[model samples]
Target: MRQRNLSIPRTSVTALVAAMAAVLYLCLAALPVHAAEGFDFYTDSPGIHVTAGDALSFNLHLAGSNAAGSDVALSVASMPEGFTGFFKSGSYEVTKVHASGDGADTIATFQTTVPSDVADGVYEIVLHAASEGGFEDDLILTLTVSGLESGESNFHVEYPDQEGVSGTAFSYSTTIANNTLNTQNYNFSSNAPAGWTVAFSSESTQVSSLEVESGSSKSVTITVTPPEKVEAGDYTVECAATSAKEQLSTALNVKILGTYGLDLSTTDGRLSFDAFANKESSVTLKLTNSGNIALENISLTSSAPAGWEVSFDSSVIDALEPGASKEVVAHVVPGKDSLTGDYVTIMSASCDNQSAQASFRITVKTQTGWGIFALVIIIAVAAGLYGVMKKYGRR
Candidate 1:
């Protein structure tokens, strides 16, 4: 060994150095190399709550330690039936996120959507983020849904506006949707005008409050009755549907077009009249518009004793204003053979599907000519009888 140290050649030293380098390389190669912790997915708010028909979003942060900016694939590992989850980067929706592991482009948006018709309840979703280096993370998200959605109306009307006349019912078909996880007792109320009545009914049964099941809908009939003398115009009925957790209000329109009416009578309002047989008598008839709307094309007709004739000077009135009247001349003639007795006559006025009838009585009197003839016959009979008696005595 002393001789080798003293006389060691440069080539030998070089060979030794090369051998050591090889051994070191072998040792290093035999040892396993650990992979770096690529990236991590997390959200500041892992739990949230929203009503049905609303969307929920979470701001995600991708933290890493010595990450290689690998493409992290995002997926929802678990979700409920009523929810849909997705990832977004800015305005573009994406499923793969490129994480530099250096905190650049590490923010993402996770959004979940719920259907409007879904029932209310709590839901859980698991978001999975995976990378090429077998690095992965599962984030749990929680969601709570209230029924019918908060601050949103749960009532729908097939027809919010209705048209009718006074003293009639105006109906509105309404549908109430209980998109909740629990049953509810809904109370109804209305702010109608004075002397007006508002009622809510289901299946023809009136109800002030009703119990509704979850995820179910109920149809109700809203009946609004105007006052007796309600003016013709547009009226509003404010109604509300209130539950334990929700309240919805709506305004309904009711159009009043007035009513159709006709009044037929004498100016003095006398229902009876006396008339002689085979004589024509003229009477003044008055036609009044008893409704708030105008009346037009009013036709006059009469029903009287058999063989009697009746005529109107103005058979049809062109138009009559509300609360106004028009006078017409009606000539009535009795049958020649009619006896001295009481008779009935019906006068009718009709316009615009409205009709009014008035009844009158007539008394027929015997003609003077008939009475005079009867007296003359009696006198002739007496004179003949007396002449017969005198002739018999002389014989």
Candidate 2:
């Protein structure tokens, strides 16, 4: 075989090289190939808790590395119930662009306000982004929307704050927030503490569900008043709130200070009577203490007529517990030949050596005049008989 070194012409070699170059250029110029541009949607703070009157916010980002100059436009396709969407106009300037598979990152943010009446619940938002070349992608976002915590609202009493004085009054308020994609109504209630007078402005009947706009908040105030006689110390109340959507509760606290005071009453402290000599009469005295607390160590003492006597069930009362009283008796026996227009004396009661005074009075009168008449008649008869007898003898 003749190894005919058929060397191709230099022109043929150059033309072949030119054709390869032309083919490479055609492939480069034929169409602008687009790398897939995508972003993961996320909340700036993954979970959010807000009061009924609070606002909800979420920030989004397009995270990637290495790739640049690829722009992704954003739009919100779905929003939570109470959220109001607004674009931060000059805010999302394309400072930089990032590719989906790259390691470097870029961020895009959207701001939304939660209405005061937003219902409490978990919500999901969908975000959409499009490239200038008509390529579009979407990200599913999750947000947890919750009502204000018990400690955040006035109606809620937290740990260690429990217990209220018997007479102290408590006032608390509860708020409802719309945190869902729809309108919601809320119901609120309380398991009042013992010895407390509890009242709520919320309906006793099923509360009409309130219409809360998305991204808004609404509030309600509850008032509690403790009973005047509750003992001093810690007390607990269970309060709950429910909406057409959800229910939550808090343990209310109250502190009672001291015991209630006492009031005293007496039916006329003074006593009086009228009697004849050698006659007798009696009188009664009453004392009362009306209070929540006990009265200790009560006593009664008396100074009566010279021959009269007085006594008490307890001359020294041991203790008069709340709402208790005592009655004492006095006996009067007029002395023979006792002359009395009004005989007066003093009576006293000592509570722990503290004394109170009262007075007693007695009046006396004498008996009939028949004895002197009989004696006079007898003397007249004797004188008449003596005169008759003397005259008869002298004749």
Clashes of each: 0, 39
User: Which candidate comes out best when scored by lDDT?
Assistant: 1
**What do the candidate models score in CA lDDT, each in turn?**
0.83, 0.58
Local accuracy of candidate 1 as per-residue lDDT tens digits, 243-315: 8567877789999989766788899988877788779988899989888888889899999988999999989
lDDT tens per residue, model 2, 1-395: 76767789999999999999999999888743333543343344555544454444445554433223466567778987666765443456432233353323334555666566767666666777665545555666555556533433222332325344456556655555555554445556667755566655544332434444655666554556777666666767776666544565666666665454433223564467677677666666665554455657766777766875555545766776666767666556677767857887676766642346667677776554545787788899998899999889788
**Clashing pairs for predicted structure model 1, backbone only:** none
- Best candidate (score: TM-score): 1
**Runs in model 1 with CA error above 4 Å?**
1-148, 372-395
**TM-scores of the models, in the given order?**
0.55, 0.31
